[model samples]
Target: MAVTCDLSAERFVDRWSDYVGAPPLTCGIVDVGERTRPTVSGVDPDRVRTVSDPGNLQHLHDAVETHLSELPDADRTVVYLDTVNALLDHVPIPSVTGFLDRLTSSLSALGAVSCASFETGERGERTIRPVTETFGTVFELGRLGRSLEPTDDQLSSDDVFEVLSSRSQRLVLRSLLRAEGTLHVRELAQRIAAAQTTEQPDIEQIVTRLHHIDLPKLRETGLVAVEDRVVSATEVVTEVEPYLALAHPDERN
Candidate 1:
């Protein structure tokens, strides 16, 4: 059985680089459906590859296989299968379950491991439950987002201090920095709440504190800003990109 894990692209790439004793590996983002694919800026254009219409399982498998083949034996490969939810949308519960069964089997055959991160409304939670129960690992990226750090080189002592000064602030900052944007506090809270597998104190209160207090301090440092209820990272690429490039370089290219 393969180990399944969920992490943001930053954390995943960082760990893979460490595990292989290599610089950062490039990633390819494939849109498995026919829609406007979301864009992730600052990601190297040369490093990214894409596949359209992965709704067809054979096409999905072939794309993944070809991508994996291109990597050096020592390099780790990650397939960001966006819209696992979108893929299942409108399908009957039993049909969705059957699809996952086949998808996992196919992935295993390709020597690839797969994991998914998604939001859960009560209705979505019902469908997600069985998938988690069956899969050995289920990670909540929003909750886990709080604990993640950019590669050491990517962050400075001031950055660490700024983040650690307040727990509420830290959580907000970490989430925005990871996503490369400001987010509504309510959304941030929901994400953090989900990532936490264990029960906790009032999450709403926590978010309130972050919005009132922590966010102000972060803004003073020019690390974050808020317009209305939304908060976004400030000058993140200027602060972290060089360090990321240094920490994870492409040897082949």
Candidate 2:
């Protein structure tokens, strides 16, 4: 006899939601591409203690150490490290292996599952080695740019600003946007540090400035809804698509 199970995405989300609410712990996100946006929706906004750019393994390691304090003693924490299109340039085998070893040691100490997803390509082969050696589950997310889909989950304040504002602000916004919703100033700072790349400017001061000034400007414009450290995007796609088109006309197909 065959058996049926409710394993649809909605059912998975519902079950995951219940788990998040009952026992809280720190969950880490090592987002390496624009794909950072979707992983943000996987956990409760309140429970996400650390979100870092996996591009910098050292920073990723440090963030995990700091946030491990927030997890429950017995409840297992999980780390979702995503390195899709982000590591296509030079392959660093030693650094990658070292980071994975450290990450494995940390997660094992806490009794957590360290899940890593890599996009399939020559790069994926280079990237997945460390993750597969350390973590139990590894998923291949096909080629980059071909299957990029943003979740219908409400846009975070950071994502809205990214799609609407200038480049510098957009960088700052992407990290914050990926958080379940709003985030504390310190949390945003850590994320900015982790997500920093050569092309992006230093965001420490800008993050501070947002609390005092720019956030209000965005709120006044109805682009963002701010209540303390929490920020939500109020503007829908229709309002932002034109701006996006102006900024990135090449994205038009």
Using lDDT as the measure, the top candidate is 1
> What tens-digit string does per-residue lDDT give for candidate 1 at 1-253?
1111223334444556679776344555443444443343434543333445434555555555555565544134444454455545645666656656666665666666665555554456677786555443445445445233565434555675655654455556556656667678788776556544458757877687777777777776667778888877877434532233232122101
Task: Kindly report which residue pairs in candidate 2 clash with one another.
Answer: none
Candidate 2 lDDT over residue span 34-120, tens digit each: 222332355454433332343566765776666555656523565544442343233366666677788777777877656554544
Candidate 2 has what TM-score? Answer: 0.35
Off by over 4 Å in 2: 1-54, 84-91, 124-131, 136-253
lDDT of each: 0.53, 0.49
Error of 2 at 130 (Å): 5.3
TM-score, candidate number 1 = 0.37
Q: By how many angstroms RMSD does model 1 differ from the true structure?
A: 16.1
